[model samples]
Target: MSVSPQDVEKVALLARLAISESDLPEVTERFGRVLGLVDELNTIDTETVVPMSNPHDMHQRLRPDAVTRQNDRENLMASAPAQDQGYFLVPKVID
Candidate 1:
């Protein structure tokens, strides 16, 4: 599980990265170690394990779906430039 300097150079070219000649060796070594760790993880048997949506067992609390407030129409109409029948009026944008 190792990547060559040529492999790293080709990858850098494809990824649009500017890697110097000196950095190629370090990048190749790092990528090889990453591939090795991935190889190690491939040894695990997860066929019998149950998939989880979250690591911690927690649920969100929600309020009851009921009306809890009412709008003060007179107070709201006072702030508008023009209002008619408890509604704010705006300039017509289209016919």
Candidate 2:
């Protein structure tokens, strides 16, 4: 899992990092170790494992999508800073 200086330089170019030549060796070593850890993880046994999106298995309860009457237009408009006719008025942004 040892990484060469050239490999580090290529990674730097791809990532747009400005790593110096002297620092390439250390960066390569660190990056190689990280990749080695991932390689080790790939060797773990999980053939019969089930994939999970979340820990909880309970589903959300859904209600009927029916509309209900709520005739309170004046109460709704009371919260607006400015209103004209039946629409809320705001500062003009376009010419």
Candidate 3:
């Protein structure tokens, strides 16, 4: 679980990060601290904890789904440069 300088270097390379030699030790120490925190958290027991989508026990109020706009397909399609059989046409992009 301990993070070494080599481990930090490898992680930096994999993540495409630029870490100078002078900062490698500091970066390794910080990474080790993060891992230690994770290890500490892993020791806690949560078998009795209930899974929840939100911390607050409340239901979201949603408006009823209803159509509010009139259909104007023909008027919209009239502005298109190219269209065919009620469908807008575009130049062929792939073979």
Candidate 4:
């Protein structure tokens, strides 16, 4: 769980952080504390604990899947500036 100055430097490089030489000792100590906490958590017994997808046991209510709107494509296409074969046409802007 102990973190070295080099490890802190590597972490800073990976995170794209601008860490000064003076800050290395403090950063390394903080990282060491975090690693120690994680190491402590690994010692807990979870053999009887069940994994959960959600904290609460509940099912989501869903409405029946059915089309509710009438087909109005013909009325909609009449307002388009330019349309061809049921698709709106536009000028090519890219090569």
Q: Best candidate per lDDT, number?
A: 3
Model 2 lDDT per residue over 1-95, tens place:
67788888887899999998778778888999998999898899878888767789977789888878677889999999999999899999797
Model 2 ranges off by over 4 Å: 50-95
* lDDT comparing candidate 3 with the true structure: 0.92
User: Candidate 3 versus the native: TM-score?
Assistant: 0.49
Q: Summarize candidate 3's per-residue lDDT along 1-95 as a digit string, tens digits.
A: 79999999898999999999998989999999999999998899978988779989998999889988798999999899999998899988797
User: What does candidate 1's lDDT look like per residue over 7-85, in tens digits?
Assistant: 9888899999999988888989999999999999879997998977889888778999999879878875787889887
lDDT per residue (tens digit) for residues 25-50 in model 4: 88889999999999998899878988
Residue 94 in candidate 3, Cα distance off native in Å:
24
User: TM-score per candidate, in order?
Assistant: 0.47, 0.48, 0.49, 0.51
List RMSD in Å for every model shown: 13.2, 10.9, 9.3, 10.5
> All candidates' lDDT scores?
0.87, 0.87, 0.92, 0.89
Candidate 3 segments whose C-alpha is farther than 4 A from its true place: 48-95
* Distance from true location, Cα of 57 in model 3, Å: 9.4
TM-score of 4: 0.51
lDDT of 1: 0.87
Local error of candidate 3 at residue 18 (angstroms): 0.9
Which residue ranges in model 1 land beyond 4 Å of their true spot?
48-95
Cα deviation of 8 in candidate 1 (Å)? 0.8
Poorest stretch of ten by lDDT in candidate 3: 46-55
